[model samples]
Target: MNPLEKVIWILVAYVFGCLNGAYYVGKLYYQQDIRELGSTNAGARNAGRVFSRSAFIVTVIIDAWKVIIPLWIAISFWEMDTIILGCMAIALLLGHLWPVQLGFRGGKGVVVYLATALMLAPIPLVVCGLIILLGYQLHKNLMLIAMIGFSSIPLNLFIFYRNIELTVVFFMMLSVVVIMHRNGD
Candidate 1:
C-alpha cells in the first residue's frame, strides 16, 4: 500500500477499535452500561458480568477481532515496518481506552493488547495468559494478575526473543495499559 493508503488503513483500524460494542450490548440486554456495573469500564469483562453469557461472548468476539482483523489486514496489504505497525497497535489500544463512539469513554484495553501479543509474539502471549490465569486463581485478584502478566511481557521478550525493539514496544504498551487501569488498584 502507498503511504496515504497506509495512513487511511490505520485510521480505519483505530475507528474500528474505538467502537463500543460492549456498551451497546450491555444496554440492549441489561439496560445498563456494563462498565458502570462491573469495573465501570466499557470492556468485555464488564460486559460478561452485567449481561448474559451470550452477550459476553459476543462482546469478546467483537473486541478481540476488532484488534486482530485490522492489523492482519494492514500487514497483508501494506509494506509498513514493525515500527509503523507498532504505532498502529498503540492507536488501537488508545481507541479502546477512549473510544469516540462511547463519548470518549472506553474499556481497560486488555482485549486489544491480547490481540497485539497474539499477532506479534505468540509465545509471550501464551506465557502471559497462563500467568494471568494462574495468578488470578492463586491470589483472586484479577487486576493484580493482569499487571503481573503485562509486566512479564518486557522481561519475556528480552530473555527469549532478545529483541530490543519488541521490548520497547512492550514497555510502551504496558505503560499505557497500566496507566489506564490505575484507578483499579
Candidate 2:
C-alpha cells in the first residue's frame, strides 16, 4: 500500500482508539468523570467502581472492540500488511493512553493490550493470563498483576507471531502503559 493509505489507516485507528468507553459511559450515564474516579483510569476496572458493574462489562467490551474492529477491517477487509498493522496497533495504544478527547489523560491500556494480544496472538495472551494469575496469587495487587502480565506482551508477541514488527508494536504499547501507570493507584 501507499504511504498515504497507511497514514490514513493509522489516523482512523487512532480516532477509534480515542473513543474511551469508560469516560463516555461515565459522563453520559452517571454525570461523572472517570478521570476523577479511582486511579483516574478511563478503563473498565475504574468504570466498574465509578459507574456500575454493567458499565465495567460494557467498557471492557467496547475497549476490546474499539481496537479489534479497526484491526479486523484493516486485515480482513482492507487486506493491509502486517507491518502497517503494527503501526496502527501502536497508534491505537497511543490513542488509548493519551486520548485527544480527554486532554491527553487516559487509561493504563490493559484493555487495549489484552485486545491486541487476543487479536494477534491468542496463545500468548493465555500464557500471559496465567502469569497474571500466578502473580496475583503471590502478591494479590491488581496493578502488580497487570504489570507482570503486560510486561510479557512483547515477548509473547515474539514467541507467538515471530514478527519483529508486532513485537516492536507490543513493546511500544507496553512502554506507554508503564509510563501512563507510573504513579501508584
TM-score for each of the candidates: 0.86, 0.90
- Name the weakest run of 10 consecutive residues (lDDT summed) in model 2: 176-185
- Tens-digit per-residue lDDT, 25-71, candidate 2: 89888899999988788888889987789999999998999999999
Q: With candidate 2 superimposed using the best TM-score fit, by how many Å does residue 34's alpha carbon deviate from the native?
A: 1.9
Q: Per-residue CA lDDT of candidate 1, range 1-185, in tens?
A: 57786687678868877976688788877788776776677887777766767887888788888888878877777656777687788888888888887778888787788788887777998899899888988998878888898788778999988988778887888888888877872
Candidate 2 at residue 131, lDDT?
A: 91
Pairs with backbone N, CA or C atoms under 3 Å apart (clashes), candidate 1 = 35-40
After superposition, candidate 2 runs with Cα above 4 Å error? 159-161
Best by lDDT: 2
Winner by TM-score: 2
Poorest stretch of ten by lDDT in candidate 1: 75-84
Model 2 error, position 72 (Å): 0.7
The Cα local distance difference test for each model comes to 0.80, 0.85
Clash count list over all predictions: 1, 0
